[model samples]
Target chain A: MNAFIIADNIISPLGFTSSENFDELKKMHTGVKRLEKSTLSNEPVCAAVIDTNKLDAAFQKLSAKQEYTRLEKMVILSINDCLNQNKNIDISNKKTLFIFSSTKGNVDLLDASLASKFDKKRIYLWETANVIAKHFNNPNQALTVSNACISGVLAIILAKRLLEENKYDTIIVSGADILTHFVVSGFQSFKAISNEVAKPYDVKRDGISLGEGCGTVVVSNNKSLAVTLSASSRAESRDEGQASAIIISGGASSNDANHISGPSRTGDGLLLAIEKTLKESNVKASEVNYISGHGTATLYNDDMESLAITDAQLASVPMNSLKSYFGHTLGAAGVIESIIGIHSMRENTLIGTYNFNELGVTKPINIIKNTQKQEVNNCLKTAAGFGGCNAAVFFQKHR
Target chain B: MVNGTEVYSDSSLPSADFIKSAYKHFQLNYPKFYKMDHLCKLAMVASDLLLKHNPITKKYASEDIAIIIANSASSLEIDTEHQNTISDKNNYFPSPAVFVYTLANILIGEIAIRNSIKGENTFFIFDKFDADFMGSYNNSLLSSNKATCCISGWVEFYENEYEAFLYLVEKEKNELNIEHTSEQLNKLYINQI
Candidate 1:
C-alpha cells in the first residue's frame, strides 16, 4: 500500500504515449479495424493492431540491431519512455528489478509441426525477458510472469510484497503480448473473437477483439524520487510543481474454483478479491471514486463483473472498459488500463467506453457512457483471465 | 519440507497411471482428476500428498489457504501436445479441453478446486528453483493476512522430464515438523531433506 507509481507509459496502436492514447479515447477513436485477411485469416475479424512501420522507426532509435521481436520492441520502447522520464534512478542497479508479464510471450516462435528447426530455447518466455533485461543493463535476471491475463496486476502485487520486504528499491513492471496466429487461432477456436468492434456491457456486444500493446509502470518505495519525476514532467504529465503520485493501496487475486476458461456465474472469486482489497486499503466500498472494469465484452465475463461490482457495493461508481478502445492486450491489459486510470484520476476526467451504447447485463450498474469530469481520490482495477484467475488492485492519489 | 508425509515419482512409471495410483492411494473421488493434463496432474498429485501429510479441511477455512507454483518448463509438454493438434492442416482442431491446461498456473486452479481453497494464487516462471522467493513470499502472505497457510513450491513437467517439491508453509513454527527456511527449502528441493 506504500509503493508509488512514479512513472508509466502505454505504447499501443492509438499512440506511443499515455496522453496520446488517452486523447484518442477522449475523441472516442478506436484502434480496432478489420484484420487483413491475408495475414490473419479468411474470416472477418476486427482487432486493435499496431502499425508495423511506426514500430520499426521507434525500434531503430532504440537499437541498431533488429534482434528484438515485435512484442519485445513494444515492451522495451514503453519501459524506456518511463525510464527516460526518471533519469535520476540507476536503472541497471541491482536493487532495480524488472518483471515481464504476458499471456503468450513468443509463442509464435514454435513451428507449426513442432518439427521446425527453430531454436527451441526461443520459445521460453524467460529467454525473451533476459534479452530485454540485458538491453536495459539490469543486473538481476528478469522475472517472467506468464499467468494468463492477470499477470500484469499480479506483477504489481508481487512488486509491493518484495518492496515491503526491502528487497528492492525500484521495480519496473512491464506487460506485453502481441497478436499472433497461435493466439488468434486459439481465440477463434473458442469462438470468443468479435467480428466487429467490441461493445463492452452493451446489448449488442458479441465478443472480444484481440489487441496488441505494451505497458510499463515504474513503482518505487521512495517518495522523494516521485517528487523529482513529477517535477521533471510538469509540462507533459502534471501541473506546475505539483508533486503527486498514485499509491498502490491494496491488491489480491483469487481463483474461481469452478472452471478454467469460463468465469464463475456467481462472481464469487472476484467478490473475494475486491473484499480483500477493500479490507487491506481500510477503505469503504463507497470511498472508491472510479472503477476500471476489465470488460473483455465477452458474455459471461461482463455479466460476472457487473455482479461482482454490485457485490462490492461499487456499482454506483463511474466505470469504463478501455478494451473497447485498445482491445484486449492479454497480459498488458491490467497494467495498461491501470496506468490510464491513474492518469485519469490525476486529471479528474474518466474517458467513456469506445463502443459501448447499451447495458445488456441483468445486474444494473453505472457504466461511464460519456467522458465525465469529477474529483477523484481512489480507484479499483480488476482483471480476470483464462485460468479463472481474478485480480483486484486498488490505487489512491496521494496529496 | 514435507511435515510427516511426502510423495515422489522416479519417472519410471507412466504419468497417467501414477496419477491414477495416487487417486486410489488417497481414495479420492474427484472425477476431474483424469481430465487434467500432465502439468496439472503433477501439481494435484503433489498437493494431495502434502494435504495427506497435514490436513487442512478441519483446521483452516478454505479461503485461508493459498497456493503458489513455480516451474522451469511451464506447461511445455502440454503446449507441444496442443501445438501438435493444430499443427497439421488436415487435423486443425484446438480442443478447449487440451487448450485449457496450456498455462502452468491452471494447476493452481485444479488444486484449489479439489481442496476448496479460495485464496490468492499465482504462478512464476523461474529458470530454476528460487529458495528466497519461496520462503519470503510465503512468509509475506501470512504476515499480511493474505493467506493463513500457503502451499508453495516448484513444479515442472515436459516430455518425461519432471520434478515437483511442494512445501506447506504456515505462520506457526510448531504447526509443521520442518523449519520453513531457505536452507531447509533448498534441501527439500534438492532431495537433501
Candidate 2:
C-alpha cells in the first residue's frame, strides 16, 4: 500500500525542473525580489513571480493549440515535465487518476478584462481542472482540491489513501497558483506580504513574501512504482549502485477551530496533525531525519511552528523552511516544498533556511541556517493555512 | 432539510431570503452567521439541519469525525466581492474578512468551529456533485479507521443560486438503514426526497 514517488517537476521563478530549482537552492539563491511596480499590486511589493516570456516559451514547446490561463499553463507544463521523467505510467489508463490542488485556479479570470477573453466557466477551479485533464485526453474527470494552502499535501494524502484502497495504480498530483491582483491585494490588506525577501524564523522577519509557482508529482503503489533518483544522486550512489524508492508513508489533516484567519496560539491543532501523522507512519519522533516546515515568515505562523516542533519532541531535528527561497507559493508550496524535500533526501543535502539570522520564536529548535550535506533518510513536511487548517505528511526512503 | 426532504420551510422564497428565514425559523443563535458570506451561510444552515437530527459529535470523539464537502462555484460569491474591492485601484479597499472567505475551505472551518469537530477536514471542487468519488472516499475514511463518522456532501452558493445536501456517513447503520453507494447518493441528491 506504499505510495511511492515515481517522478516530479517544479515550475517556479527559480527554475522549471525540480533539479534546476534544487541546484539553485544548493547555491543559496532565492527567487523573491522587490518588485518596484507590478500589476499584482498598486504599491511596491516583494514576490517570486515566474517570467511571462519564459513560461510562454516553455508552454510553446508543448505545442498546445488551445488557449489556457496562466495557472493552467503552469499546471500543464508541470505535469507534462513530470510525465516526461518517467514514461512507464500511462495517464490515459483508467487506473490512473488526476488530482489538481490549488487555492485559486484561474481566479484571475474574475477580472472583466480577462473574463471576456476566456470562457467565464474557466474561473471555476473544477472547470480549470477539467481543461488540464482534457489536455492529456484522460477520460476520468480530474478531482480538484482547493483547501487553501494545504491543498497540495492533502491531495497527495488523498492519492495515498486511494492507492492503499487499491483504487488507482497511478495518481498525478499537480498544485499551482499564479500571482494576481486578487491575491496580492488580499494579502496586502492583511499586511501579510513582506516588504523584502521573507526571513523565516528570523527575529526581524516582518511578513511573508507571496510567490507563484506550480509543482507536480507522480505517486503510485509498488505495482507501478520504480526507484528513480536525480542523475547526480544516482552517480553519487554508484558505490552501492542501489536505488531507493521514496514513499508517501503517512499523513493527517486537522483544524485549529480557533479562528478562521489566525493560527492557534498554543499550536495544539498543528501538533495534533503532526502527532497523528507520526503515529500513522509508525515512525517515532526521534527517527525523523529532517523537517520541512510551513514557515510563512508571518509573526504568528513561524511562532506556532516553533511551538509545534518543540512540543512534538522534534526540536533537535535539522529543520529548514524553503519559503525564503521560493516565497510562499500557497497551493504550490506543499507540493513544491515536498519535492524539494525529496531532492534533499536523495542528494543527502539539507538546504538552509535562507535569510535566517537569529531565533525569533519562543521555543528552541534546530534550524539549518546554511546548505550542508547530511544523511537524510526520512523527512516530515508540515503546513498550516487560513481557515485554521493544518496538515502533516511523512516521506521515507525505502531501499 | 433532512436527507433532501424539507423538514419545515418554504423552498419558493428567494435564495437569500430563504436562508435568512431558515436561520430565524431554526432559531440559530450563532452571531457569526450574520457576518459570513453566502457560501458559508448556506453550509451553516445545511449542516445545522443535518446535525439537528443526528448529533454525531456527541457520539464520536472530535478527532474521529471528518468533513468532506464539495461544490461547483467554490466561494466565488465572496470572491467576486473581494475582487471588486481591489478592482478599482483608485478606491481599493480589501478587508481581511472578505479576503479570508475567498478560500472555499473557510466554510469547512466554520462548520468545524461550530461543532468543535477537529478531525480530517477537506474541501473539494467539482463541476457537479460527484457522488461516486464522495461515497467511495468517505467509505475509505471509515474503513481505514481515519474517522468513525463523517459529515459529507455538496454545498454550492454562487450569484443568487444555491443548494446544499449534506448527510452524515457513519459505520453503524442508522434508523434509515440506507446503504452508502453512488447510486443511492444520485437518488437522494436528484429527487431530494
Candidate 3:
C-alpha cells in the first residue's frame, strides 16, 4: 500500500500560505533579514517570525478557545488550512491519527511558567496534543514527536506506517516551532547563529539563522493531483535500491556516534541513511535528480553534508538548501523542505541555493547557484539533529 | 528486535544490600562508562544478559545494530534542575553540561557509543504506551533493513519515579510468534496486573 501527501499548508518567514510561498520562491525572493533594533545582538537578528496576533485571529475562527501559545496557534492554523482545502473528507468517524512534530512544544510557555509560576498543567506536552485533537474532534489516537530537527520527517514516516497498517483512515502530520530565548541562546552559545542572512553552500557562509514556522500535510489513502510518489515499492521492503522516480521509495535514520552537537567528519552515518533510502527505493545514485540538503550554513554541517553526498556517489545531483531563503526552521525544516521540493518538482523548476558565489567545501556535487528550469522526477531530502540523529526521505512525482 | 536494561534509585538504594552488591559486581566486571545514568547502566546489564551465549557482537559489524528509545518526561527532572540554575534572577545563565541531556534520544547515543554499535537511531515521545505504534515502528525499522538488530524500549524518569525496559528484537527467520504482538507487550507492561 502506497501513501501520498494529498494537501499541505505552510506558514514561514517566506509567506503564510502555500501559494504565497510558492510565488515568492518562483521570484527567488527570501524573507530572511536583519533583526529589528529592539531584538538582542548576540541573538543574530535574522529570523522568520510570524505575526502571532494575525495567526491567532485566523485560528479563533476555527477554534472555540483562544488561549493557545504561538506554537499551538501555528499548528492549529496549518491544520485548519489542510482540512479546509481537502474539504468534505469524512474524518469525523474515522480513526484519524495525529502526529505532531516539534522540538519545542510550547517550550516558551514552559520558560514563561518558570518565571511567573504559572500553572504547570497548562505547559505539559501532552496537553498540547490534547488541544489539537480537541479542535479537530477526531477519535483517532494522537502522538507528539520531539526528535530535534528530524521530528518533522519522522512524523510523516510514522504516519505512513500507521496508514499502511490500516490503523487510521486519515493521518494529520504537523510540525511547528517558534523562536524563543531558550532556543536562541542555546544556538548562540554554540556559535551556530549567522550574523547576516544565511548563505548556504557558500565559501563565506558562517552559521544558521534561526527561524520559526509551522507546516502540515494531510496524508491519506485518498489520491489527488498534489500526491507525491513514494520511493519505496513496498511498506515492508528493507533492501536499499538505487534512486528512482523521486518516490519516497525507502529511507532510514541513524546517529553519527561521533558527537552530540556535530556531524561526523567522515559522513559515515549520513552515508548509511542515503544508502538505505536508495536501496529501498530501488534506485541508483545516478538516478537522483536533486538533493535538498540540511545545509544550515554552519561550517561543520555544510562540509559534512557535502562529503556525504559525494561519498554516496551523488556528485551530479543538483543540491541546494532553502535555509538561505527562510533560515533554519529547526524542527519544521524537514517537512517544510519536503513540501518545497515537491512544489519545485511539480513546477518543473529548480530553486537556487541563495547567497552562493564560491564553493565552500571541496566536493564534486553540483551546487544550484541560481534558479534554473529543469525536469525533476526524483529528489532526496535529508536532515541531521543534535543527538547525532540523521534522517533521509526520497520523493518522486506521482505518475 | 529492540533490547534494553535499566537501574532505578529506589528509596532503599544505599542500604539495600542486594542492589549494592549488584553495583559492586557491575563496577568490577563492566566498562567504567556503564556506571553513569540508570538507563545506561541498565542497558549494559540487560545487553550483557541478552548477548550471553550469543554470537551477535562477533558476527555483525557495529553499524548493523541500532537503538530506538521512547520515553515520557523527556529528561525533565534533569531539565528542571538545569533550568533552576539559569532561572535565578541574579545568576541567569544556563549550564552547557546540563543542557546537553535535555533531549531524550541522547541515551541512545550514549548506549551506541559504549557498545560501538552504529545504526538507525530515533527517540519517540508519547504520554502513555501504545502497543500498536510500537509494533509498527519496530517492524518498519526491520523491514527497512536499517538495522539487523534493534534495541527498542521505554525509559521514563521523573523526580522520584523511574522505570525502563529494553528488548532486543531481530527478524525471525521462521514465522513470527503470534502471541508477541505489540498489543500483548503493551498489555504486559503498561496495563498493570
Candidate 4:
C-alpha cells in the first residue's frame, strides 16, 4: 500500500511548470522581489504574483466557459501542468479523486458577493468544487480541505489514504492561495508580514513576505523515482504533542496552542512534532541530513523553529527556509517546500538560507549560509501558520 | 477496555447554564471549556462522552492521544461573522482573534491542550456523513499504530443547530459487548432509544 507521487506541478515566484521552476532553482534564482501589484498592499516587498492576463489566456485555451477566481486559476494551471507531464494517462476511466487544499477557497468571491447579496448556493463549498471540476472535466469525487497551513499536506495525506484503500486509482492533490486584501490585511493586522524580503534563520530577520502561488501532484499506487509517502501523522496531544511533532517516519502536524497568531516561546509543540516524525520514520535526530523550515522570517517563527530543531537534537542538520526565496505562500508552503526538499535531495545539494547574515535566535542549529553540495539522504520540511498550526514532513532519497 | 457515557445540554436551561452543565458532566472547569468557541463546545461534549473522563490534566502528556474530527460547515458561522465585520468600508480590518477561529481544526488543538493528550490530529470535511470514509480513516490510523487512542467522530454546527457524536477507538484483543460495525454506530445515533 505504498502511495507514490508520480508527477508534480507548481506555479510560484520562480516559474509556471515544475521543470521551469526546477531550472530556476538550479540556477539559484528566486521569484521574490518588491511588490508591484495595485490590488495588494503598497508594501515594496512581495513574491510571485501571477499575471492575470496570462493566466486568463491559458484558462481560455482550456475552455471558454470556465470562470475562475485568482485562487482557482492557480489550481487549474498547476493541475494542467501535472496532467500535461503524464500525457499518456487516461483520466476518464480512472476514479480520480480531487483533494483541494486551501485556507481561502474563492473566499474573495465571498468578499465580492458581500457588497451585493449573492445566493448562498452560489458561494458555498460545493459551488467552489464544482467550478474546478467543470473546468478540468473531472467527473470523479471532489473534496476541499481547509487546515490553515497544513491544508495542502493534509490533502496529500488524505489522497494517499484514498489510494491505499483502493477508493481511487489517481488522486490529484492541489493547493492554491492568492494575495487578496482580505488575506493581506488579516496578516498585516497580526503584524506578521515583513517590510523586506523574508530573511529566514537570520539574526536581522524582521518578518515574513506575504506571497501567492499554487502546487499540485498526481499520486497513485504506482512507484517511480519519487519517494513513496510512507506515513502522515498529526499531533493529538495536549501539551508535549501540541506541535504534532514531526515524529512520523514521514510527516506530522503539531500546533502550539499558546497563541492564536504567534508561536510558543518554548517551541514545545514544534519540538514534539519533529521528535514524533523522527521516531515514527525510524530516523534518528543525528541521521537527518537537512531541514526545510517554515522560515517565515517573522521574529517569532524563525526563532521558534530554530529552538524546536535544537531541542529535538537536530541542531547540526543543515537547514534553510525557502520563504527567503518565495516568501510565505501559506497553505501552499507544505507541498511547495516538499517539492523543493525532493529536488534538493535529488541534487545532493542544499539551498542556502537566503538573507541570513547572523544568528538571531539562540539555537544550536546550523543554518546553511550558502548553497552547499552535500549528500542529503534524509530531509525534513516544516511549516507553521495561524492558529499555531505546525507541520513537518520527512523525505528520503529513493534508493 | 469498553466504556460509554453521554451528556446533553438541558433544553430548559439558559444557554450559559447548558454550557456549564455540559462542562460539569465532563468534570472540566467551566472557565476551561468556556475559553473555547461554539464548535469546540460541540466537540468537547462528544469527546467527554467517548473518553468517559477528563484527559486534559497536566499529569498526562499530550502526545499519547489523537483526535480525528470530521465536519460539514467547517467554521462557516465564524467565517460569516468575520466577513460581515470586514464588509463595511469603515471597519475593513478583521479581528485576528476571530480570524484564527476560522480554521476548523482549532477545536482539535483546543481539546488537545485542555486534555494534555497530544497525539496526531486531523480535521476532515465531507459534504455529508459518509460511514465508509469514517470507518476507513479510523481503520487506517489504528492499523498504522499512529495513535494508541483516538477521539474520532463528526461534529456539525451552523446557526443554532449543533450535533456531535464521538467514539474512543483503539485496537483490542477481547471482544466487547457493544457492536463495532458502522451499522451499529449508525443505529446508536438514529435510535436514541
Candidate 5:
C-alpha cells in the first residue's frame, strides 16, 4: 500500500517549480523582505509575497484573459505545471480525485470593496476548487480541505486513504494561501508577527513572518505492486523503476486539546501523532534521519516542537524548518516543505536551519546549522497550528 | 448508534437559543462554550451527546479514538462576522478569538480537550455531503489499526440553519442499532433522527 508522489511543483517568491526552489535552498536564499506602508500595516512589516507582476505574466501565458484573482492564478499555475508533464494520467478521468487545501480561499474578497463586486459564494472554498477543476477540463468534482495549518498534510493523508480504497487511481492536491491585510492584521493582533525576519529555535526569535505560496503534488499507488518472483524474491516493481520515487509510509493527525492560539507546554498531542505514524509505518524514532519541523519561529511553537521532539525521542535527529526560507506559507507549508524534503532525500542532502544563532528552548534538541551531504532514507514532517491541531507524516526514499 | 442529534431554528427561539437549550439539556458547564462561534458550538454539542453515555471508550487508551468531521460551509458564517470587523477602516478590530475558529477543525480541538481524547482527526470541506468518502475513510482508519473507535460524521452550520449527525464507529459495540455505511447515514440524516 505505497502511495507514490510522481510529480510535484512549488510556486513561490524564490521559484516556480520544486527543483528551482530546492536550488535556492542550497544557496541559502530567502524571500522574506520588509515592506513600508503596505496594505497590511501602517509601519514597516516583513513578509514573503510572490511577485505580483511576475505572477500576472505567468498567468497571462496560461490564459489570454485578465480575469483570474491572485489566488486563482497561483493555484492554476501550480496544478497546471504538474499536470503538463504528467502524460500517463488523465485528469479528465472520473477516477482521478482533485483536492484543494487552503486555510482561506479568496479571503481577500472579504475586503469591503471586493465584497461588493464578488458574491458571497465567490469566497466559498468549494467554488474556488470548482474553478480550478473547470480550468483543467476535469469532470471530477473537486474537494476543498480547510484544516488550518495542517490542511496540506491532511490532504495527503486523505488522498492516501482514497488511493488505498481503489476509488481513484490518481489524486491531485494543491495548497496555497495569500498574505493580505485581513491575515496580517489578525496575526498582528495576536502579536505573532515579528518586525524582522524570524529565527526558528533561536534565542532571539520573536515571531513568524507571513508568507504566500501554492504547491501541487500528484499522488498514485505504486504501479509495481505486482511482480515476478525469482527464488521467492523480487528485484524491483514497475513503479519503483524511477530512482527518485518517494512513498508515503504513514500519516497521523492529532489535536493539542489545549489553547487554540498557543501550543501545549507538554507537546503531548504532537508526540501522539508522531508515535502513531511511526507505529503504523513500522518505523522507529532511532531510524529517523531527518525532521522537517513546523518551526514558525514563534515563541510557543519552537518551544513546543523542541518538547515534542524530545518526548518522541527524536530531538537528536537533524532538523530544519523551511519557514526561514518561505516564511510560513500557512496551508502550503506542509506540502511545500514536504516536497523539498522528498527531493532532499532523493538528492542525499540535509538543509541548514536558517536564522538560528543559539538554543532557544529549555529542552535540548538537534538543529542543523549547515548543509550536510548524507544518505537520508526515512524522514518525518510535523506541523502544529491554531485550533489545537497537529499532523505528522512519514516518507521513505524508494529504492 | 451511540448517539444522534440535530439543532436548528425554532419559531419560538433563535438558532443561538436552540444551541443554548441543547447545551443546558446536557448540563455542560464549560465556560468556553459561550465564546465559540456557531459552527464550533454545534459540533461541540453533537460530540458531547455522542460520547456522554458511551462509557465503552474508557476501556481503550486516550488516543484510541479518531474523529473525522466535514461540512459544506466551513466557518462561512464566522468568516462573515470576522469580515465585518475589519471591513471598516476607521474601526478595524480583528479579534484573535474570532479568528481562531475560522477553520472548521477548531471544534475538534474543543471536543478533544473537553474529553481528554488525543487521537487522529481531520476536517474536510466538500460541496455536498459525501457519505461515501466518510464511510470509506473511517473504514480504513479502523481496519488499519489507527483507532479502536471513531467519532465520525458531518457537522454543517450557517447563520440560520444547522444540522449535525455524529456516530460512534468501533470494532466492538455495546448494543447499537446503527451500522457504519452510507445508506444508514442517509437514513439518519434525512429523517434527522
Candidate 6:
C-alpha cells in the first residue's frame, strides 16, 4: 500500500508552479529580498513574500465567484494547478480527501484592520479549509493539520496512512501559510528571523528568513493515475526510456520531549524518526542518495540536523536545504521541498544549498553547495519544528 | 474531570481557579504546570487524569504510543495573547514564551515531555469534534502497527471555555469493554459534554 505522488504544484515567491520553482533553483535564483518597512514589521526585515498582484491576477483566471484570503488563494491555485495536471483525479468524489496544512491560517484576521474583509470565522483554520474544499465542491469535510512547521510533512504522512487503509483513492495535501504581522512579530520576538538571505549549514548563518507560499501534492495508491510533471519533463528532455514511479514509501513523526521551542540537543528524536521511516520504506541508509533537509539556517537547527544525520549514519549522503531559495515557508516547506526532491529523483539532479559556503555543524555531513547532476533514486526529507516535533519521510523512485 | 466524569468541579470558581483547584486536588507535582497556557494546562490536566490510574508508559514502549488531538480555535487564546504582544506598535514586546504556545501542538509536546512518550504526534483542527474521523484514524494507527496505543480525542480551549475529552485506544480491551467505534466515541464524548 504505497502512496505515489500523482501531481504537484508550488505557489511561492520563486514561482507559481513546481517546475517554475525548480527552474529558479537550477539557476540559483533566490526569492528572498530585503524589505524597508513592510506592514508585517516596523523595522526592516528580510523575507520571501509572494507578490499579491500576481497571485490575485492568476487566481482571477480561475473565475472564482467569491473573494479569498491571500493564503486561501495560494492554496486554491496550487491545488487547482495540481489537479489540472492530473485530470484523472475526481476532486468532488467521496473517495478523494482534501487535507489542508498550515501553522497559522488567516492569522492576519487577528488584526482588526484586516479582519473586516471576511467573516470572523475565517480566522479559524478549519473554516478556511472548508472554504478551500467548498471551492472545489468537495463534499467531504477537509481535514486541517496545524502542527507548527511540520504540518506539511505530517499532512502527507496522514494522506499516505489513509491511502494505505484503502479509505480514499486520492488525497490532496495543500500546505500554505502567509506572512502576517502576527507571525513575523512573533518570530522577531524569538530572534529567529534572519535579516539577510538564509545560509543553511553555514558558519555565518544567523536565523531563518521567513517566507509565505502554498504547495499542493496529490498522492494516490495507484501509481498509474498520472506521471509526475517533473518525471514527464525528464522523459521529454532526456532520452530516458521509462520514468520511475515516484512513491512515498514511508513516513514517521516524533517529538523531542526535550524542549518546546528548541530542537533536541542529542538529535535522538529526529534520528528515531529517520530510522523508522527508512525501516518502513524498506530502504537502507546507503540507498538514500539525497537528503532534503529542513535547514532553517538557525544556528541550533542546522547543528541539530547535522547531528541527526550523522547519528542516522547518513552523513555522507548529499543534502541541501531549499530555505535559501524560498526562505522558510514553515508549513509549506516540507511539501514543496519534498516535491523538489521527487523532481530531483526523476531528473537525476540535486539542487544545492543556495547560500551555504562552509560546514558549521559539529558533525560532518555532506551538504550540497551547488546544483549538480547525479543519480538520485531515494530522497529522505526531514523536518524539525517548534513543539519539539520532528518528521522524516522518504520519496523513492520505483522502476 | 476524567472522561466527562467530574473529579472536581465548582460553579462558583472561575475557569482558571477551577483548573488550579483540580491540579491541587490531583496533587500534580509538575511545577512546569504553572508556565503552560490555558490550552496546555487543560490538556496536561486531562491527560494526567486519564493516564493516572492506567499509566501507558509502564504498559508500552515510549515509541509505541501516539497522541492525535483535534480542536477548533487552535490556540487562538494564546494566539490572541501573542498577537497583543506585537499588535501594539507603541509597546511591542513579544516574548518567546508566549509566542511558542501559539501553536496548538505545543500542548502535545507538553504531554510528551511530561510522560517522555515520544512517538507519532499530530495536532488537527476541526470545526467541531468529528468522532468518526478520530475513531477511524486512531483505529487505523493501531491496526497498522504504527502505534500499539494512541492517546487521542478533542481538546479545545478558547476564550476561557475549555473541554478535553481524551481516551486511550489499545488493542487489548480494558474493563470498560467498549469497542473502538465512532458511535461509541460520540457517546462517550457527548457524555463528557
A1-399 per-residue lDDT for model 4 (tens digits): 565566678888678886577667656676777766565554444655667777777767767564466677778878887777665334554478787777766666667644354345534554566577667778865777777787776666667666767878778887778777667766776777777777876777777777788888777665532322221111211222111111113667666766655687988887877776777677888888999888878777778887888888888878888887766777787777777776565556678776788878867678888787777677787767665666676766444
Task: Enumerate the candidates' DockQ scores in order.
Answer: 0.66, 0.85, 0.43, 0.36, 0.69, 0.87
Tens digits of per-residue lDDT for model 1 on A40-85?
4446788888999999898799764547777778988998888787
List the candidates ranked by TM-score, beginning with the highest: 6, 2, 1, 5, 3, 4
Q: In the order shown, what is each candidate's alpha-carbon RMSD?
A: 2.4, 1.6, 6.0, 7.1, 4.2, 1.4
lDDT score, residue A80, model 6? 93
Question: What is the TM-score of candidate 2?
Answer: 0.97
lDDT of 5 by residue, A1-399 (tens): 678887788999999988789888877888888898787675689999998999988888885443666898998999878876556667888888899999988988878767776567778888888888888878987878888999988888777877888878889899899988878877887889888988998999999998999988888885442111111112321223324557888889988777777899999899988998898788889999899999999998999999999999998999988898898898888889888888677667788877877988868899988777877887899988887889999988655
Query: Which residue pairs in candidate 2 collide?
Result: none
Candidate 3: list runs displaced more than 4 Å: A36-44, A113-119, A224-247, B1-10, B14-25, B28-55, B59-61, B143-146, B173-179, B187-193
lDDT per model vs. reference: 0.83, 0.89, 0.70, 0.68, 0.82, 0.90
TM-score quality measure for candidate 5: 0.93
For residues A237-335, could you state the per-residue lDDT of candidate 6 as single tens digits? 452844577888899999898889999998999998999999999999988899999999999999999999999999999999999888888888889
Query: What is candidate 4's TM-score for chain A?
Result: 0.87
lDDT of 2 by residue, A1-399 (tens): 678898999999999999899999999999998999999888899999999999999999998989988999999999998788887878998988999999988988899888998987888998898999899988888999999999988988888988887868899999999999899989988988888899999999999998999999998885334654433357755324433678998999998888899999999889999999999999999899999999999999999999999999999999999998988899999999999999888878899899999988879889999999878888999999998899999999885
- Report residue A82 deviation for candidate 2 (angstroms): 1.4
Using TM-score as the measure, the top candidate is 6
Candidate 4 regions exceeding 4 Å error are A26-29, A41-48, A93-95, A113-119, A122-127, A130-134, A137-139, A224-249, A255-260, B1-28, B32-36, B48-61, B173-176, B189-193
Whole-model alpha-carbon lDDT for candidate 5: 0.82
Candidate 3, residue B20: how far the Cα is off, in Å? 11
| Candidate 5 regions with alpha-carbon error over 4 angstroms | A64-66, A116-119, A223-243, B1-10
> What's the C-alpha lDDT at position B12 in model 4?
85
Q: After aligning candidate 2 to the native by TM-score, how far in Å is the CA of A189 from where it should be?
A: 0.7
Residue pairs in candidate 5 whose N, alpha carbon or C atoms collide under 3 angstroms: none
lDDT of 1 by residue, B24-64 (tens): 77777677888888788777777887887688766788778
